[model samples]
Target: MSETTMNTATGATAARGRGAVALTVARVVLALFFAFSAFAKLIAHESAIESFDRMGWSHGAMYLIGALEMAGAVALLVPLLSGVAAMAFVGLLAGASVVQLTLLDPVNAIMPTLLIVLVVLIARDRQDSTAQLIALVRRRA
Candidate 1:
């Protein structure tokens, strides 16, 4: 090949490699973040309960959120289910962000940003279980 063509090919390969590295890094970071956040909530159940109470959620809701977080963490670690779990966690985080905003709760302002990132990562996984979830809902209706 000509020098120019070889250089172009080399650059393209380098760019693709960089993109792959970036994607892998992003996935690992997201996985670790969800895992750690969920573990923290599980390890500090009382603190989560107290915070939930202060936020005016019912006890049942508090327990439910905790359970979901724990489940999401486990799902994050499981390759077969990670995509679905990531989606669930994204929704949970988004809902919490909305509640915080509505209640004028400044404590979770950054949560929405994190949730957005999680949504992006989930999109990379190509599961699209959202469609299935919607279908299930429609069937019940």
Candidate 2:
């Protein structure tokens, strides 16, 4: 290949490598975040308890969210399930964002809003994998 062609090819490959690394990093960070959040709720942390009570949610609701958060964290690391997990987090985080903006300080909504954007990117990036998973399940059914 010509030098220009080789440079272009190499650059494209490098860009893909970077994209993969970014995706991996995002997944790990999201997993750790949700895991810790779940731990906080499961332990009945004072803030979590107060927040749930203020929201008119029962202890059961808190526990359910904690469990779901843990499951979503695990799912984020699984190749076939990462997209699914991200999609789920989009809704979960959206709800949390709304609650933050409406019930608590609007400033508290920042994290969940940013998380929603990240998960949206992750979901878009993993669209093909998610599609394949859906196809496999369809075939099995």
Candidate 3:
């Protein structure tokens, strides 16, 4: 192959590698944030319960939501499952944002809205990763 062609290939590979690394870092950060949030809900149930009560939800609902968040956080760490987990988180965050806007101050919804955007970014990244993997598999076959 020509030197220019080789250089172009090398640059493409390096760029992909860098993108994968950045995506991994983003996934870890998001997972940690979700895991910690879930842990707080589970370990310090009183606060979660109070928050749910204000929303007219029962304590059991709080526990259920906490468990879902914990499961989603774990799934987010797995490449194959990350997209699904991020989608779930998007839904959860959307609901939380709506509740905050309706029952609490509009300012209270900001965190959930921000989390929704973060999860959307993760979901898009995961989709790109999945597409790359499929292309690789097809090329190999």
Candidate 4:
């Protein structure tokens, strides 16, 4: 290959490397946030429980959401599963944002709404990987 071509290829490779690093870091941060929230709900922590109660939600609702959050958090840490996790988070956080706006403090809705944006970015970035995973599963099945 020509020297100029090699340099171009190297630059592209470096860019992709940086993108991957950024995505991985984002995933880690999201995992931490969701895991913390999940534990609070699962443990019936004072603040978490009170928030649910104030919304007129039962214990079951709290537990169910907590479990789902925990699962998503775990999935976020796994490269293959992170895309799926991001997609799931978009849906979950959308519901949370709606509830926060309608049933709870409207201010509280900002966090979930922002998180939805972040997860959507992650989902878009990892779409190729997600498609590959689905393709592999289909081939196997």
Q: Which model scores highest in TM-score?
A: 2
User: lDDT tens digits, residues 7-122, model 3?
Assistant: 99999999989977887787888889888878877875677767877889876777778888899989999887887788889999999899999986689899999988878878
Distance from true location, Cα of 68 in model 4, Å: 0.2
| Model 1 stretches astray by more than 4 angstroms | 1-10, 125-141
- From the highest lDDT down, the ranking of the candidates is 2, 4, 3, 1
Report the C-alpha displacement of residue 73, candidate 2, in angstroms.
0.3
lDDT of 3 at 26: 77
What are the models' TM-scores? Answer: 0.63, 0.94, 0.76, 0.87
- lDDT of candidate 3? 0.84
The TM-score obtained by model 4 is 0.87
Model 1 per-residue lDDT at 107: 77
Per-candidate Cα lDDT values, in order, are 0.68, 0.94, 0.84, 0.92
Q: Report the Cα lDDT for residue 109, model 2.
A: 97
lDDT of 4: 0.92
lDDT of 1 by residue, 45-126 (tens): 6766677767787767765666687677666655556567777767887787877777647677686756668556664553
lDDT of 2 by residue, 26-107 (tens): 9999999999999999999999999999888899999999999999999999989999999999999999999999887789
In model 2, the runs with Cα more than 4 Å from the true position are none
Task: Please provide the root mean square deviation of candidate 2 (C-alpha atoms, Å).
Answer: 1.2
